[model samples]
Target chain A: AQSVTQLDSQVPVFEEAPVELRCNYSSSVSVYLFWYVQYPNQGLQLLLKYLSGSTLVKGINGFEAEFNKSQTSFHLRKPSVHISDTAEYFCAVTDRSNTGKLIFGQGTTLQVKP
Target chain B: DTAVSQTPKYLVTQMGNDKSIKCEQNLGHDTMYWYKQDSKKFLKIMFSYNNKELIINETVPNRFSPKSPDKAHLNLHINSLELGDSAVYFCASSQGAGGSLDTQYFGPGTRLTVL
Candidate 1:
Protein backbone atom coordinates (compact mmCIF):
# COMPACT_ATOMS: atom_id res chain seq x y z
CA ALA A 1 0.00 0.00 0.00
CA GLN A 2 1.05 3.61 -0.64
CA SER A 3 0.24 6.78 1.21
CA VAL A 4 0.71 10.51 0.73
CA THR A 5 1.11 13.30 3.27
CA GLN A 6 0.60 16.98 2.69
CA LEU A 7 2.32 18.94 5.42
CA ASP A 8 0.24 22.10 5.20
CA SER A 9 -3.54 22.17 5.11
CA GLN A 10 -3.74 25.79 4.01
CA VAL A 11 -1.39 28.28 2.41
CA PRO A 12 -2.02 32.01 2.08
CA VAL A 13 -0.20 34.16 -0.40
CA PHE A 14 -0.59 37.55 -2.03
CA GLU A 15 -1.14 37.90 -5.75
CA GLU A 16 2.05 37.65 -7.84
CA ALA A 17 3.84 35.98 -4.93
CA PRO A 18 5.56 32.64 -5.07
CA VAL A 19 4.24 29.58 -3.25
CA GLU A 20 5.12 25.98 -2.63
CA LEU A 21 2.94 23.13 -1.44
CA ARG A 22 4.91 20.31 0.13
CA CYS A 23 4.02 16.66 -0.38
CA ASN A 24 5.67 13.44 0.74
CA TYR A 25 4.86 9.82 0.05
CA SER A 26 5.67 6.42 1.48
CA SER A 27 5.76 3.42 -0.84
CA SER A 28 7.49 0.08 -0.77
CA VAL A 29 7.97 -0.05 -4.51
CA SER A 30 8.66 2.51 -7.22
CA VAL A 31 5.75 4.86 -7.79
CA TYR A 32 4.39 7.60 -10.02
CA LEU A 33 3.50 11.00 -8.57
CA PHE A 34 0.85 13.47 -9.61
CA TRP A 35 -0.62 16.82 -8.57
CA TYR A 36 -4.26 17.69 -9.16
CA VAL A 37 -6.21 20.91 -8.69
CA GLN A 38 -9.89 21.34 -7.85
CA TYR A 39 -11.93 24.48 -8.04
CA PRO A 40 -14.98 25.13 -5.88
CA ASN A 41 -17.71 22.59 -6.61
CA GLN A 42 -15.85 21.08 -9.53
CA GLY A 43 -14.02 17.86 -10.29
CA LEU A 44 -10.28 17.50 -10.08
CA GLN A 45 -7.99 18.45 -12.93
CA LEU A 46 -4.49 17.16 -13.50
CA LEU A 47 -1.84 19.77 -12.82
CA LEU A 48 1.18 17.62 -13.60
CA LYS A 49 2.61 14.11 -13.33
CA TYR A 50 5.98 12.57 -12.63
CA LEU A 51 6.39 9.17 -14.28
CA SER A 52 10.17 9.19 -14.79
CA GLY A 53 13.13 11.23 -16.01
CA SER A 54 13.75 14.88 -15.12
CA THR A 55 13.14 15.73 -11.51
CA LEU A 56 11.56 19.06 -12.40
CA VAL A 57 8.24 18.64 -14.21
CA LYS A 58 6.24 21.58 -15.50
CA GLY A 59 2.47 21.66 -15.44
CA ILE A 60 -0.44 23.84 -16.46
CA ASN A 61 -1.09 27.32 -15.10
CA GLY A 62 2.64 27.98 -14.66
CA PHE A 63 2.92 25.41 -11.92
CA GLU A 64 5.83 22.98 -11.53
CA ALA A 65 6.87 20.24 -9.16
CA GLU A 66 10.17 18.56 -8.43
CA PHE A 67 10.45 14.90 -7.61
CA ASN A 68 12.95 14.21 -4.84
CA LYS A 69 13.42 10.49 -4.56
CA SER A 70 15.76 10.55 -1.59
CA GLN A 71 13.45 12.76 0.41
CA THR A 72 10.32 10.97 -0.82
CA SER A 73 8.87 14.35 -1.73
CA PHE A 74 7.10 15.86 -4.74
CA HIS A 75 6.45 19.50 -3.89
CA LEU A 76 4.43 21.73 -6.18
CA ARG A 77 5.69 25.27 -6.79
CA LYS A 78 4.68 28.38 -8.64
CA PRO A 79 6.89 31.42 -9.17
CA SER A 80 3.92 33.76 -9.43
CA VAL A 81 0.29 33.20 -8.61
CA HIS A 82 -2.94 34.94 -9.52
CA ILE A 83 -6.24 35.40 -7.76
CA SER A 84 -7.72 32.73 -9.95
CA ASP A 85 -5.19 30.26 -8.63
CA THR A 86 -7.05 29.96 -5.36
CA ALA A 87 -8.07 26.32 -5.19
CA GLU A 88 -7.45 23.04 -3.45
CA TYR A 89 -4.48 20.92 -4.49
CA PHE A 90 -4.00 17.23 -3.97
CA CYS A 91 -0.91 15.06 -4.18
CA ALA A 92 -1.39 11.48 -5.27
CA VAL A 93 0.76 8.40 -5.87
CA THR A 94 0.39 5.05 -7.62
CA ASP A 95 2.75 2.15 -8.09
CA ARG A 96 3.45 0.48 -11.45
CA SER A 97 1.60 -2.72 -10.54
CA ASN A 98 -0.98 -2.06 -13.29
CA THR A 99 -3.82 -1.36 -10.89
CA GLY A 100 -3.61 2.41 -11.49
CA LYS A 101 -5.14 3.02 -8.09
CA LEU A 102 -4.20 6.47 -6.83
CA ILE A 103 -3.75 7.18 -3.15
CA PHE A 104 -4.44 10.86 -2.54
CA GLY A 105 -3.45 13.26 0.22
CA GLN A 106 -5.73 15.35 2.39
CA GLY A 107 -5.37 18.32 0.05
CA THR A 108 -3.94 21.83 0.58
CA THR A 109 -6.07 24.86 -0.01
CA LEU A 110 -4.17 27.71 -1.66
CA GLN A 111 -5.66 31.12 -0.99
CA VAL A 112 -4.33 33.75 -3.32
CA LYS A 113 -5.31 37.18 -2.02
CA PRO A 114 -5.19 40.50 -3.79
CA ASP B 1 -18.45 18.33 -24.65
CA THR B 2 -18.52 16.53 -21.28
CA ALA B 3 -15.98 13.74 -21.79
CA VAL B 4 -17.19 12.16 -18.59
CA SER B 5 -20.62 12.97 -17.11
CA GLN B 6 -22.61 12.17 -13.98
CA THR B 7 -26.33 12.63 -13.41
CA PRO B 8 -28.13 14.39 -10.50
CA LYS B 9 -25.41 16.77 -9.47
CA TYR B 10 -26.88 17.06 -6.01
CA LEU B 11 -28.77 14.39 -4.07
CA VAL B 12 -30.47 15.15 -0.78
CA THR B 13 -32.24 12.25 0.89
CA GLN B 14 -33.20 10.92 4.28
CA MET B 15 -31.42 8.15 6.10
CA GLY B 16 -32.34 4.55 5.20
CA ASN B 17 -33.37 5.69 1.73
CA ASP B 18 -31.97 4.14 -1.41
CA LYS B 19 -30.39 6.17 -4.18
CA SER B 20 -28.41 5.65 -7.35
CA ILE B 21 -25.93 7.90 -9.18
CA LYS B 22 -25.24 7.36 -12.83
CA CYS B 23 -21.97 7.93 -14.71
CA GLU B 24 -21.04 7.78 -18.37
CA GLN B 25 -17.86 8.34 -20.33
CA ASN B 26 -17.65 9.03 -24.03
CA LEU B 27 -13.85 9.06 -24.24
CA GLY B 28 -13.92 5.53 -25.71
CA HIS B 29 -12.07 4.25 -22.67
CA ASP B 30 -12.55 0.72 -21.40
CA THR B 31 -12.10 1.40 -17.70
CA MET B 32 -14.28 3.39 -15.29
CA TYR B 33 -13.88 4.14 -11.60
CA TRP B 34 -15.86 5.50 -8.66
CA TYR B 35 -14.23 7.61 -5.97
CA LYS B 36 -15.52 9.29 -2.85
CA GLN B 37 -14.39 12.63 -1.51
CA ASP B 38 -14.99 13.27 2.13
CA SER B 39 -15.70 16.63 3.74
CA LYS B 40 -12.03 17.03 4.52
CA LYS B 41 -11.19 16.60 0.84
CA PHE B 42 -9.64 13.17 0.95
CA LEU B 43 -10.28 11.26 -2.26
CA LYS B 44 -10.47 7.48 -2.12
CA ILE B 45 -11.23 4.90 -4.76
CA MET B 46 -14.25 2.75 -4.09
CA PHE B 47 -14.75 0.57 -7.18
CA SER B 48 -13.56 0.10 -10.72
CA TYR B 49 -14.93 -1.67 -13.79
CA ASN B 50 -13.24 -2.76 -16.96
CA ASN B 51 -15.36 -3.52 -20.00
CA LYS B 52 -18.44 -4.12 -17.84
CA GLU B 53 -16.49 -6.44 -15.53
CA LEU B 54 -15.74 -5.78 -11.92
CA ILE B 55 -12.05 -5.18 -11.34
CA ILE B 56 -11.29 -3.25 -8.17
CA ASN B 57 -13.67 -3.31 -5.24
CA GLU B 58 -12.33 -1.68 -2.12
CA THR B 59 -13.25 -2.36 1.52
CA VAL B 60 -16.46 -0.41 1.15
CA PRO B 61 -19.64 -1.58 2.84
CA ASN B 62 -21.91 -3.98 0.94
CA ARG B 63 -24.59 -1.32 0.95
CA PHE B 64 -22.65 0.49 -1.73
CA SER B 65 -22.96 -1.40 -4.99
CA PRO B 66 -21.48 -0.52 -8.36
CA LYS B 67 -23.18 -1.62 -11.54
CA SER B 68 -21.63 -1.48 -14.98
CA PRO B 69 -24.09 -1.96 -17.81
CA ASP B 70 -21.49 -1.48 -20.54
CA LYS B 71 -18.05 -0.15 -21.24
CA ALA B 72 -19.14 3.44 -21.04
CA HIS B 73 -21.52 3.44 -18.07
CA LEU B 74 -20.99 2.77 -14.36
CA ASN B 75 -23.70 3.36 -11.80
CA LEU B 76 -23.39 3.37 -8.03
CA HIS B 77 -26.33 2.36 -5.88
CA ILE B 78 -26.39 2.86 -2.15
CA ASN B 79 -28.90 1.09 0.10
CA SER B 80 -29.92 2.42 3.49
CA LEU B 81 -27.63 5.35 3.28
CA GLU B 82 -26.00 6.54 6.47
CA LEU B 83 -24.81 9.93 7.64
CA GLY B 84 -21.25 8.89 7.01
CA ASP B 85 -22.17 8.34 3.36
CA SER B 86 -22.78 12.04 2.87
CA ALA B 87 -20.01 13.12 0.53
CA VAL B 88 -19.12 13.88 -3.04
CA TYR B 89 -18.89 10.93 -5.42
CA PHE B 90 -16.78 11.35 -8.51
CA CYS B 91 -16.67 9.19 -11.64
CA ALA B 92 -13.55 8.86 -13.73
CA SER B 93 -12.32 6.89 -16.77
CA SER B 94 -9.01 5.96 -18.31
CA GLN B 95 -7.63 3.89 -21.18
CA GLY B 96 -5.27 0.93 -21.75
CA ALA B 97 -5.78 -1.79 -19.20
CA GLY B 98 -5.34 0.33 -16.10
CA GLY B 99 -1.81 1.46 -16.86
CA SER B 100 -0.31 4.47 -15.09
CA LEU B 101 0.47 6.17 -18.39
CA ASP B 102 -3.22 6.71 -19.05
CA THR B 103 -4.65 9.88 -17.58
CA GLN B 104 -7.96 9.56 -15.74
CA TYR B 105 -10.57 12.11 -16.73
CA PHE B 106 -13.00 13.02 -13.98
CA GLY B 107 -16.62 14.09 -14.11
CA PRO B 108 -18.21 16.83 -12.06
CA GLY B 109 -18.96 15.02 -8.84
CA THR B 110 -22.39 14.17 -7.38
CA ARG B 111 -22.84 15.54 -3.90
CA LEU B 112 -24.86 13.16 -1.73
CA THR B 113 -26.29 14.57 1.45
CA VAL B 114 -28.03 12.13 3.76
CA LEU B 115 -30.20 13.62 6.43
Candidate 2:
Protein backbone atom coordinates (compact mmCIF):
# COMPACT_ATOMS: atom_id res chain seq x y z
CA ALA A 1 0.00 0.00 0.00
CA GLN A 2 1.07 3.59 -0.64
CA SER A 3 0.68 6.57 1.65
CA VAL A 4 1.16 10.32 1.46
CA THR A 5 2.07 12.81 4.16
CA GLN A 6 1.94 16.57 3.99
CA LEU A 7 4.51 18.11 6.29
CA ASP A 8 2.60 21.28 7.08
CA SER A 9 -1.03 21.56 8.06
CA GLN A 10 -1.19 25.27 7.45
CA VAL A 11 0.95 27.86 5.72
CA PRO A 12 0.30 31.61 6.01
CA VAL A 13 1.93 33.92 3.53
CA PHE A 14 1.40 37.44 2.22
CA GLU A 15 0.21 38.14 -1.26
CA GLU A 16 2.90 38.12 -3.95
CA ALA A 17 5.14 36.03 -1.68
CA PRO A 18 6.60 32.69 -2.53
CA VAL A 19 5.33 29.51 -0.89
CA GLU A 20 6.10 25.85 -0.79
CA LEU A 21 3.91 23.01 0.41
CA ARG A 22 5.94 19.95 1.27
CA CYS A 23 4.71 16.44 0.56
CA ASN A 24 6.28 13.00 1.05
CA TYR A 25 5.15 9.54 0.15
CA SER A 26 5.91 5.90 0.93
CA SER A 27 5.52 3.12 -1.58
CA SER A 28 7.14 -0.22 -2.21
CA VAL A 29 6.84 0.11 -5.98
CA SER A 30 6.93 2.94 -8.46
CA VAL A 31 4.11 5.48 -8.09
CA TYR A 32 2.39 8.49 -9.60
CA LEU A 33 2.33 11.77 -7.69
CA PHE A 34 -0.26 14.51 -7.88
CA TRP A 35 -1.16 17.79 -6.27
CA TYR A 36 -4.76 19.01 -6.05
CA VAL A 37 -6.27 22.29 -4.91
CA GLN A 38 -9.66 22.94 -3.35
CA TYR A 39 -11.27 26.24 -2.64
CA PRO A 40 -13.77 26.72 0.15
CA ASN A 41 -16.84 24.54 -0.37
CA GLN A 42 -15.56 23.37 -3.73
CA GLY A 43 -14.46 20.07 -5.17
CA LEU A 44 -10.81 19.33 -5.72
CA GLN A 45 -9.11 20.46 -8.90
CA LEU A 46 -6.01 18.87 -10.31
CA LEU A 47 -3.02 21.10 -9.98
CA LEU A 48 -0.48 18.78 -11.50
CA LYS A 49 0.63 15.21 -11.77
CA TYR A 50 3.90 13.35 -12.30
CA LEU A 51 3.51 10.09 -14.17
CA SER A 52 6.84 9.48 -15.87
CA GLY A 53 8.96 12.27 -17.19
CA SER A 54 10.85 15.25 -15.89
CA THR A 55 11.13 15.37 -12.16
CA LEU A 56 10.01 18.99 -12.22
CA VAL A 57 6.34 19.20 -13.20
CA LYS A 58 4.52 22.45 -13.90
CA GLY A 59 0.87 22.87 -13.20
CA ILE A 60 -1.97 25.32 -13.55
CA ASN A 61 -2.16 28.65 -11.74
CA GLY A 62 1.61 29.04 -11.87
CA PHE A 63 2.19 26.13 -9.50
CA GLU A 64 4.93 23.54 -9.87
CA ALA A 65 6.17 20.50 -8.04
CA GLU A 66 9.47 18.66 -8.17
CA PHE A 67 9.46 14.90 -7.76
CA ASN A 68 12.43 13.90 -5.62
CA LYS A 69 12.78 10.15 -5.73
CA SER A 70 15.64 9.90 -3.25
CA GLN A 71 13.85 12.06 -0.71
CA THR A 72 10.45 10.59 -1.52
CA SER A 73 9.12 14.07 -1.77
CA PHE A 74 6.94 16.01 -4.23
CA HIS A 75 6.75 19.55 -2.91
CA LEU A 76 4.50 22.13 -4.58
CA ARG A 77 5.91 25.59 -5.05
CA LYS A 78 4.83 28.94 -6.36
CA PRO A 79 7.16 31.91 -6.90
CA SER A 80 4.38 34.42 -6.29
CA VAL A 81 0.92 33.93 -4.93
CA HIS A 82 -2.25 35.98 -5.03
CA ILE A 83 -4.96 36.34 -2.46
CA SER A 84 -7.11 34.08 -4.55
CA ASP A 85 -4.54 31.36 -4.14
CA THR A 86 -5.66 30.77 -0.60
CA ALA A 87 -7.02 27.24 -0.59
CA GLU A 88 -6.52 23.75 0.72
CA TYR A 89 -3.94 21.62 -1.06
CA PHE A 90 -3.65 17.88 -1.09
CA CYS A 91 -0.84 15.53 -2.02
CA ALA A 92 -1.81 12.16 -3.40
CA VAL A 93 -0.05 9.09 -4.74
CA THR A 94 -1.02 5.87 -6.44
CA ASP A 95 1.02 2.79 -7.16
CA ARG A 96 1.39 1.33 -10.66
CA SER A 97 -1.26 -1.26 -9.96
CA ASN A 98 -4.28 -1.87 -12.11
CA THR A 99 -6.53 -0.43 -9.42
CA GLY A 100 -5.03 3.05 -9.67
CA LYS A 101 -6.43 3.90 -6.29
CA LEU A 102 -5.21 7.21 -4.92
CA ILE A 103 -4.01 7.66 -1.36
CA PHE A 104 -4.17 11.27 -0.23
CA GLY A 105 -2.45 13.24 2.47
CA GLN A 106 -4.26 15.16 5.18
CA GLY A 107 -4.01 18.45 3.27
CA THR A 108 -2.36 21.84 3.80
CA THR A 109 -4.30 25.08 4.07
CA LEU A 110 -2.54 27.92 2.30
CA GLN A 111 -3.72 31.31 3.56
CA VAL A 112 -2.56 34.03 1.24
CA LYS A 113 -3.25 37.30 3.01
CA PRO A 114 -3.12 40.82 1.73
CA ASP B 1 -20.97 22.92 -19.80
CA THR B 2 -20.28 20.77 -16.79
CA ALA B 3 -17.98 17.85 -17.45
CA VAL B 4 -18.97 16.11 -14.24
CA SER B 5 -22.03 16.81 -12.12
CA GLN B 6 -23.56 15.71 -8.82
CA THR B 7 -27.11 16.15 -7.63
CA PRO B 8 -28.39 17.52 -4.27
CA LYS B 9 -25.38 19.65 -3.47
CA TYR B 10 -26.31 19.55 0.21
CA LEU B 11 -28.04 16.77 2.13
CA VAL B 12 -29.18 17.01 5.73
CA THR B 13 -30.87 14.00 7.24
CA GLN B 14 -31.35 12.42 10.63
CA MET B 15 -29.39 9.47 11.86
CA GLY B 16 -30.63 6.04 10.78
CA ASN B 17 -32.13 7.57 7.69
CA ASP B 18 -31.20 6.54 4.19
CA LYS B 19 -29.96 8.86 1.49
CA SER B 20 -28.41 8.74 -1.93
CA ILE B 21 -26.14 11.01 -3.94
CA LYS B 22 -26.13 10.92 -7.69
CA CYS B 23 -23.27 11.62 -10.06
CA GLU B 24 -22.96 11.88 -13.80
CA GLN B 25 -20.21 12.68 -16.25
CA ASN B 26 -20.48 13.70 -19.88
CA LEU B 27 -16.78 13.52 -20.65
CA GLY B 28 -17.26 10.17 -22.40
CA HIS B 29 -15.07 8.54 -19.76
CA ASP B 30 -15.31 4.88 -18.98
CA THR B 31 -14.29 5.07 -15.34
CA MET B 32 -15.97 6.73 -12.35
CA TYR B 33 -14.99 7.02 -8.71
CA TRP B 34 -16.41 8.03 -5.35
CA TYR B 35 -14.32 9.69 -2.68
CA LYS B 36 -15.09 10.84 0.83
CA GLN B 37 -13.69 14.00 2.36
CA ASP B 38 -13.83 14.37 6.10
CA SER B 39 -14.14 17.57 8.09
CA LYS B 40 -10.43 17.81 8.54
CA LYS B 41 -9.92 17.73 4.78
CA PHE B 42 -8.78 14.14 4.68
CA LEU B 43 -9.81 12.24 1.58
CA LYS B 44 -10.16 8.53 0.86
CA ILE B 45 -11.33 6.55 -2.11
CA MET B 46 -14.44 4.55 -1.38
CA PHE B 47 -15.31 2.91 -4.69
CA SER B 48 -14.56 2.92 -8.40
CA TYR B 49 -16.29 1.64 -11.50
CA ASN B 50 -15.31 1.09 -15.11
CA ASN B 51 -17.77 0.54 -17.92
CA LYS B 52 -20.55 0.03 -15.38
CA GLU B 53 -18.60 -2.71 -13.63
CA LEU B 54 -17.27 -2.56 -10.11
CA ILE B 55 -13.50 -2.32 -10.01
CA ILE B 56 -12.20 -0.87 -6.76
CA ASN B 57 -13.96 -1.32 -3.47
CA GLU B 58 -12.11 0.00 -0.43
CA THR B 59 -12.51 -1.04 3.20
CA VAL B 60 -15.65 1.03 3.62
CA PRO B 61 -18.61 -0.09 5.67
CA ASN B 62 -21.29 -2.13 3.99
CA ARG B 63 -23.79 0.64 4.72
CA PHE B 64 -22.22 2.64 1.94
CA SER B 65 -23.26 1.14 -1.36
CA PRO B 66 -22.28 2.43 -4.78
CA LYS B 67 -24.25 1.76 -7.94
CA SER B 68 -23.38 2.44 -11.56
CA PRO B 69 -26.33 2.22 -13.87
CA ASP B 70 -24.30 3.20 -16.90
CA LYS B 71 -20.87 4.31 -17.94
CA ALA B 72 -21.72 7.93 -17.16
CA HIS B 73 -23.58 7.58 -13.88
CA LEU B 74 -22.53 6.47 -10.40
CA ASN B 75 -24.77 6.72 -7.36
CA LEU B 76 -23.98 6.25 -3.68
CA HIS B 77 -26.59 5.02 -1.27
CA ILE B 78 -25.99 5.10 2.45
CA ASN B 79 -28.13 3.10 4.82
CA SER B 80 -28.58 4.02 8.48
CA LEU B 81 -26.22 6.91 8.25
CA GLU B 82 -24.06 7.66 11.26
CA LEU B 83 -22.56 10.84 12.57
CA GLY B 84 -19.20 9.73 11.24
CA ASP B 85 -20.75 9.68 7.79
CA SER B 86 -21.29 13.41 7.83
CA ALA B 87 -18.85 14.63 5.25
CA VAL B 88 -18.50 15.71 1.65
CA TYR B 89 -18.67 13.12 -1.11
CA PHE B 90 -17.03 13.81 -4.43
CA CYS B 91 -17.55 12.09 -7.77
CA ALA B 92 -14.83 11.91 -10.40
CA SER B 93 -14.28 10.29 -13.78
CA SER B 94 -11.35 9.43 -15.95
CA GLN B 95 -10.92 8.41 -19.54
CA GLY B 96 -9.85 4.79 -19.06
CA ALA B 97 -9.34 2.07 -16.52
CA GLY B 98 -6.67 -0.45 -15.49
CA GLY B 99 -3.66 1.86 -15.34
CA SER B 100 -4.75 4.54 -17.77
CA LEU B 101 -2.95 7.82 -17.17
CA ASP B 102 -5.94 10.04 -17.93
CA THR B 103 -6.69 12.86 -15.57
CA GLN B 104 -9.73 12.55 -13.33
CA TYR B 105 -12.29 15.32 -13.48
CA PHE B 106 -14.19 16.01 -10.28
CA GLY B 107 -17.74 17.11 -9.64
CA PRO B 108 -18.72 19.93 -7.29
CA GLY B 109 -19.36 17.45 -4.46
CA THR B 110 -22.33 16.61 -2.22
CA ARG B 111 -22.18 17.66 1.38
CA LEU B 112 -23.92 15.15 3.64
CA THR B 113 -24.76 16.28 7.13
CA VAL B 114 -26.20 13.62 9.40
CA LEU B 115 -27.93 14.94 12.44
Worst lDDT run of 10 residues, candidate 2 chain B, spans B96-105
lDDT of 2 by residue, B4-111 (tens): 999999999999999999999999999999999999889999999999999999999999999999999999999999999999999999988835366778899999
Q: State the lDDT at B62 in candidate 2.
A: 99
Give the chain B TM-score achieved by candidate 1. Answer: 0.98
Q: Give the residue spans of candidate 2 off by over 4 A.
A: B98-100
User: Against the true two-chain complex, what DockQ does each candidate achieve?
Assistant: 0.82, 0.71
Clashing pairs in 1: none
Extract clashing residue pairs from model 2. Answer: none
Show the lowest summed lDDT stretch of 10 residues, model 1 chain A: A94-103
